[model samples]
Target: MFNDRPFPVDAFPKIIRNAIYEVEQHTQAPQGLIAASVLGVISLACQNRIDVCRLNNLRSPVSLFLLTLAESGERKSTVDKLLMKPLYQLEENLFEKYTHDLTIWKNDEAIFNIEKKALMLKLKSDIQRNKDYFATNEKLKDLLQSPPKAPVRFKLIFNDATPAAIKDHLCGYWRSVGIMSDEAGAIFNGYTLNELPFINKMWDGATFSVERKSEPEKLIRNARLTLALMVQPDVFKGYLQRKGEAAKGIGFFARCLICQPDSTQGSRKISSPVVSSEHLPVFHQRLMEIVNDNITLDNKNDRLCLRFSLEAENRWIEFYNKVESDMGFFGSLSNCKDYASKVAENMARVASLLHYFNGNDGDIPLSAIEDAVKITTWYVNEYIHLFSKPNEFTLAITEGDELYWWIKNHCNRHVVPYITKNTILQYGPNKFRNRSKANELLNMLQSQNKILIGKRGKTTLIAIANLKPAI
Candidate 1:
C-alpha cells in the first residue's frame, strides 16, 4: 500500500521546525517543499564541519541528497529563496574577500617574477665571467621556492555544473559545496545526469580518481557535496523514461530522499499578514553562525565527529534490522529494496544533522534518532508511492472505478437513452482517451452487466443498464 501523508514537521528540531512553519505561513507552499529547502540548507552548512560514526565505527559525512517533485506554481523557488538567504549572504562575503585577496596575490606574483628574472640574469652573468656563481644560484633557488601562494576562492553553491567542473572546483577551491536549484530542468534534462555514477560516489563520501586527457589525474578525496533539486513532475518523468533503468542499476536514486508533495496551488489565499518576519531572521542568523564556524574549520582542515549514545546505538540497530527485514521477499518494501537498504543510514545522517544544528555536544541522543525515524519513514512510503508498479488486476480495478463514476454522473444529468462512444473518448476521463483502453473498459463493463453497448447508425453507444435520476 502506498501512503500519501503530510510531512512530519514536528519531528524536526525546533530551529528547523520554526523556519519551515514561517516559510509555509508566508508562501503557503506545501509543507514538504519548505521542509526540503530547509534541510538542503542544513546539509550544506553542516557537511564540511561534521562527520558521523556508524555502529561499525566507520565515519561518514553528514551530507544529504534531496529530490523534490512538484508541479509548476508550487512556490518552490519562493521557499528556497527564503531558506537559502544565509548561504547567499555567505557567498557574497566570500566573493568580497576573494576579490581583495586576489589583488594582493597578483601583485605578489608580479614582484616575485621580476625578482626571479633579475636573479637569473645575475647567475648567467656570474657564470659567464667565471666568478663565484654559488651566491646567485642560491638566491635563485630561494626565490623560486618562496613564490607567493594563490588565495583560495571559496564558492559554496552551484546551480548548473558538469561533473568535471564540480571535481575541479572541489579539488582546487572549496572542499564543500552544494548543487541546488528550484527549477532543475538543466540538471535533469541536460547532460548533468549522465554522470550519475560519479554523483553516487560523492554521496557515498568515497574517493575516486578523475582521469583527464591533458591534465594530471586528480584524486578527489574528503570532498563533500550536497544535492537538492526541485523539479516539476513532467521533467523528472522524462528523465525516468529515458534513463531511469540505468540510474537504478547504478544505485544513484537509492541515495536520494525523494518526495512528490500534493500541490497547494489554488487553495493559497492572500488573506493573512506576512509572519515570516518573526521566525526567518532567527533561522538565517543561526545558519550564518554555523556557516561561519564551518568556514573556520574548513580552513583548518578540522571536522567534528559525532557518535551515538549507547541507548541510541541500540535503537539504531533495531531500526536498521527492521528496515532490512522490510526488504525481504514478503515485506511491504520489497518492491523498493534499494531505497530501503539505505533508508536507515540516511536516518542516521538526519539524526546527526539535527543533533548538530541544535548545538548538542558529546553523543547523539535517542530522541533525535526517534525523530529522524519518523521523518525517514515518511520518505520511505513516498519512494514506494512514486516508484512502485501496480499489477494489472489492481490497475484495472482502479481505472474501472474511475470510468464508472464518470459514466454514472454523465448519465444521471442528461436525459438521453444512450451516450455515444465518441463523447466518452472526447469528454470523458483523460486516461480513457485511447480507443483500445476505452473499448477494453466498455467490454469489461458490459460483461458485468453494468453498461449496455450497442450501435446507433455507425456510432457506438453506451447506456447504463439500470439508470435512475435524482429528483
Candidate 2:
C-alpha cells in the first residue's frame, strides 16, 4: 500500500529541516531518512525537559523510541555522526565533571563514615554513664540526621546497554537519558532484550524498585529514556523470527515510532557538495543551551514540570476524540490499535519537544501542537502500513506470502504450472522437511483461492490457481 499521507515535511521544526537539508546535501539519502535522524537528535536533547510539561490534563514523559529502517549503505551512520556530535560532546564533558566529582565524593564519604563511627562510640559511652547522657545523645542524633548528601553522576546517553545497566545509570546518573544506536541489532538481537521490563516501565515514567540481597532495595523514580535506533530490515526481520510475537505482546515494538524510509539506493548520480558547516554551529549552540540548563529537583528530588496552553489543550481534546473513534471503527488499524491509540499522547510529547527546542519552559504553543499532530498522524499511518497484522498471524502471513512468491518465480523459470511432490518437498519454499507444514500452507493458499493441492501416487503436488502462461 502506498503512503497516501506522507510525512509533513514542512511542519517539521526549522532547525530540523535545516539539519536534514545539510545531511541530504552530502548523503544523497531521502529527506525522510534525514528528517528521522534530526528528530532523534531533538528527542535526545529535549526528552527530559519537555517531559515535565502536560497537555489536556495528562502529563506524559516526552520519551520517543524512534526506529528508522534503511539498507546497509543508506548513510545511516553518516547522518547519525553528523547530527549526534553535540550529544557526544556533551557526554564527554559530563564524564569529565563526574570523574572529578566522584573522586571528591568518595573522599568526603570515607571521612564522614569515620566521624560517624566516633560519634556512635561517644553516644554509646554517654548512654552507659546514664548521667548527662540525654544532652550528649540529642547532639549526636542531630549530627546523624544531617549527614552529607550523596553526590550523583549526570549522564545523558547510553549505547548497547542492558535494561539492568540502564536502570542503574538512570538511578546513579541523570533521571533522564537515551539509548542511541546506529546499528540497532545490538539492542534488538541481544538475548536480554526479549524481556524488556525496564523499558516498558521507564517510558511511562513509573516508579520501580529493584531488590538486592547484598544491598538495600533501589527505588527508581522519574526515569525518562529516549530511544533512537537505525536498523536494517533484515535484522529487524530476524528479530521478528527469533522473538516471534512476544516482543509485540509485551508492548516493546508498540512504544517505537518506526519509520521505513523509501530506499535511496541506485539514486546517487554524482558526488554532491558538502553541507555548509555554518548551520551546525548554530544548531549545536541551541542544543547546548538546553543541555546546560539547571535541572531542578522536586521534594522527591525529581525534575519539575510545565503545563499546556489553552489552545493546545483544546486541540488535544479534538484530536484524541477523533483518533479514539478511528481506532474503534477502522479495520486497517485493528491489529495496531494499541500503538495507534497513543498518537495523541505522542503528538503532545513531540510538541513539548519542539517547544523546548526554542528554550521555552512554559506552555506549549498551538503551532507546535498542530505540527506535532500532523507528524504523529503520518507516523501512525506508516505504522499501520507496516504492522497492521495481528501478532499471532504475522508469521503465518509472512511465510505464506514468501511461499507464493517463491512458487511463482520457480514456476516461471521451469515453465511448469505444477510442481512435483518430491521436488517441492525437498526444494520448495520453506523446504517442507515436515510434510504437514507444507500441507498447512497449501490449505492456507487454497482458502485464499490462490493455489490447488492434490495427491497422486503417494506424491503431493502443488499448482497455481488461474495460472498465467509464461511470458
lDDT of each: 0.82, 0.71
Question: For every model shown, what is its TM-score relative to the native structure?
Answer: 0.83, 0.74
Clash-forming residue pairs, model 2: none
Q: lDDT at 29 for candidate 2?
A: 74
- Cα displacement (angstroms), candidate 2, residue 431, comes to 20
For model 2, how does the per-residue alpha-carbon lDDT over 237-259 read when each residue is reduced to its tens digit?
Answer: 77877784787778877787877
Model 1 segments beyond 4 Å from truth?
274-276, 298-300, 390-471
Worst 10 residues of 2 by lDDT: 389-398
Residue-level lDDT tens digits of model 1 in 1-471: 123457899999888898889888888888888888888899998898898997767788889999998767788888988889768877899999999999999999999999999999999899899999998899899999989999888899988788778888877747888999999989998866679877888888888788889888988888898999999866887788788889987898899998876556434668767465677888788788888887665455767889999999999999999988888999988988988888988999999999998778889999999999998898888787677753321222357645664575455445465678887787664567799999999898888888888876798878787862221
The lDDT, on a scale of 0 to 1, for candidate 1 is: 0.82
Tell me how far the alpha carbon of residue 399 in candidate 2 is from the true structure, in angstroms, after superposition. Answer: 12
